[model samples]
Target: MIVAVTYRYTEDVALRDEVRPAHRDFLRGLADAGSLLLSGPFGPAAPAGALLLFRADDQAQVQAWVDADPFGTRGVVASATVTEWDPVLGTLLPAL
Candidate 1:
């Protein structure tokens, strides 16, 4: 199943920037392993959050993976949530 991982970043912009590279690397590893499908920041016009898509066995697995984030370990994430997502039509799939 697909899991949607949402992250609410801390208000400390410097801390967020400092941990971004490590966080990106962690996500990259998941993508390389076929777990991460899509991910990005919410944009300046929106709230300070990130959305990540993951292909995983279940919510528990998704939670476990997300809990391993460097940012989370370092307390850069103010809050996080994992939800099971079932896509019907459009998605972030690679172009044919």
Candidate 2:
């Protein structure tokens, strides 16, 4: 299954910046383990949030990953939502 996670950042820019390296490192680890499919922040302006795609068994698994994220642990993320996604029309992902 594929899960999509959206993270709303806190207004504290300094904190988010400080935590970003660790957060990316964490995501890199997930990617190395074949869990993270894609991830990037919404940016070029003041970042409001980020989107992440993950290969997981279910929503709960993705939610657990979110809970363990550095952003969440350090309070840089104000909120996170996880939802199941069906990729039917994307060449980037195989049809499911």
Q: Model 2, stretches more than 4 Å misplaced?
A: 45-47
Best by lDDT: 2
Clashing pairs in 1: none
TM-score of 2: 0.92
Question: Model 1: runs farther than 4 Å from truth?
Answer: 91-96
Taken over the whole model, the C-alpha lDDT of each candidate is 0.88, 0.91
Per-residue CA lDDT of model 1 for 2-94, tens digit only, reads 889899988989988999999999999999999898899999988899999998888999898888999899888899999988777664444
TM-score of each: 0.91, 0.92
**Against the true structure, what is every candidate's RMSD?**
2.1, 1.8
